[model samples]
Target chain A: MNREYKTGEIQAGKPVQQVPWLEWLAAGIGLFLVLGIFGVIGWQALNGATVPPVITVTVENVTPVEGGYRVLFRAQNTAGEAAAQVEVEGKVSTDSGEEVSQVVIDYVPGHSDRRGGLFFTRDPSSGTLAVRAIGFADP
Target chain B: MTSERYAIGLARAFGGAIIFGLPLLMTMEMWSLGFSMGRGRLLLLVGFTLAVLVGLSYFSGFEKTFSLKEDAMDAFAAFGVGVITSTLLLVALAVITFDMSWGDIIGRIALQSVPASVGAMLGRKQLGAEQDMQAEEERKQEAGYAGELFLMLAGALFLAFNMAPTEEMILIAFQMTPWHALALGVLSMLLLHVFVYSIGFSGQESRPEGGTFLSTFLRFTLAGYGIALLVSLYVLWSFGRTDGVAVAEIANMLVVLGFPASLGAATARLVV
Candidate 1:
């Protein structure tokens, strides 16, 4: 073990000693400890994390008025945060998949928080209404 | 690549993903899950991603005693195995949490994964065969140091964006604890390594003596079963938590945790 590099052994230099089992074991433990700490922290964070407010759309009662029915929708930020721009669309269809009518509304989210309405001439019993919302920051 | 190098590579890829991608996904998941965005959200997301990546890096290094020159094909095969295994584990999570009925979960996955699977298969073919073999040889020659780094970085980024549940996307779903994530990550890597070795040992060149195939199959199956059990436990534990947790969130995390290993394996297999 004490022999210096001889002639033949001089080709590649010196032999590398294998890591001891104790060193490996210690390293393993240290690694786990670090991981466990992060794990706990992340767990807590996920459990108590918050999210952004969403633009909400609600449809009011649908009653027959003349040929089409009247539908009312309200949009608001229930969280009271200022959303920039809001756009809502509605599609009315008959039970046979016939498109009765559609409408779109656009407004500033916080500044123009208001309710709007639309009228569609279609059979009430066989009609379905679908609404979608898209929001953005207004320039 | 050596096992040590592979592990290091996974660490870097995964770590990079968390740092860069986790926040965006988390934000999306949280918002989707109906949580209000606040100051702590960013910090929490960043912290969690870093933590998971660090854990993965450590685990990869821990497995360095094993050989790393195992071909990439073995890793891809292991990933295929993992997808099946993760599916079952996910089913168990759904059952335990009651977030989704088994029927519903299975049905949705069946519908959704078809496109994804088709895409992966086609993409795999286009990536080349002999090129992969040459690359594998080159990686081996380089001691897999660079390959590991590339993989770890790529994996981490992919997960941060595509895998971690976004705030807005967190719906009625399950959540995973870091313990579960760490365990599952390590367990998946181990199973993949075993599969790699089993494949090598089964080869005519690698094992000229050619022992019984049943013994190899049995050993691999048993190890796979053991890994499945551990993964199931992690999934079960994750689904048990529901405080603003969406079923998609846990599901997404599982993908993030498992994706890198699978990707690294698949990439190697495809290239080799």
Candidate 2:
């Protein structure tokens, strides 16, 4: 067996076993992607996303589902931690003072918008739908 | 690299990625973390994973020999293999697609890559046959108690990080009764001690100073499990999995996370 190469060990006119081209290619691409992930996440995190004390819920669309009408809503979390089992309540003004419906969202990651639905007996479109984040427990 | 040699390594890496990263690839919370994890935290995790990869390369990596530059390069290469394999699998499963934002695409692939990279680094060690019992003997001679402990810690971290971000960890804890939790705790400690004691992996330190069953258990096995729990708790916190829960709940979460972590610790010698 040939002896192992020492540090900077090479002979004149003998082509060093070409460091496998694939290794270099792999190394380069890996570093680039890792740094890219950091750059993308860091930039957005610093500039755009912030986890507020409370999630802000906005009703996006009111659609009819099987049992009742569903309120399609988005909750925006700007904070640093994910909130699970977030309770969102929707209140609509009808001829009766108000009709309230509540739904629990499974998970809302910080700094992202997650869509959920609130099933309501009354039509949300007919009346004004006011959605609010009632409470969230940390996962 | 020889064509045949490269083929073997690539195949091993592919298999390793699937074996290690498949569950995480399918997990929704993992997908969530991939996209929504704060940049600062994700960057730190990536950096930490890189450092650990380099260290693992020093002990047991895909490379045949230990060279700093080579190990560093191989670390990146291993990570590349991890990323590529993860991307392909997730895409095949439709977990990743063209319509998703760049953040989501990058997040899921990169997060899963962490475990995949470790598996890639460990491919030859775990998947391939042992070629050098001499090297194994040398490692056993040189890797004293502290070194063995480090390997266990690395193993714990690798396994704990895989599942800590998911909501299921806490959910499982909540589902378990106190008796079940205690039974699991006893099982964890027992398994940890048994694996390290009965199994003779390459770096199994025969005995630390003051060698005795009691001493070994107290010093290494018990301590190793402690590190596993601590690592579990830390990973949970870092992922914000433990953000607003009660202290008791946190303890449960740690134990739940610690189970796999302890298994990792017990098997560290085989992998690292």
Candidate topping lDDT: 2
Cα lDDT of model 1 by residue, A18-62, tens digit: 333443333354344334433533443454322232566778767
Which candidate has the top score in DockQ? 2
Against the true structure, candidate 1 has what lDDT?
A: 0.36
Error at B140, model 1, angstroms: 6.2
TM-score per model over all chains: 0.28, 0.76
Candidate 2 local lDDT, B89-170, one digit each (tens): 8899887777555655777787888888888887767787745556644554565566677788889998887778777898
lDDT by residue (tens digit), candidate 1, B1-272: 23453334333323332333223322322222112122233233333333333322222222222222221222222222222332443344342134422222332222222112222222322332222333233334343333433333333333323333332223212355556556655666555444444455321112114646556434433333333333332422332222454665655444444534343342332222
Clashes of 2: 5
Q: How many residue pairs clash in each candidate?
A: 46, 5
Q: Where does candidate 1 stray beyond 4 Å? A: A1-139, B1-136, B155-163, B166-186, B196-198, B201-272
**Candidate 2: Cα lDDT at B93:** 86
Fnat of model 1, as a fraction: 0.00
DockQ of 1: 0.04
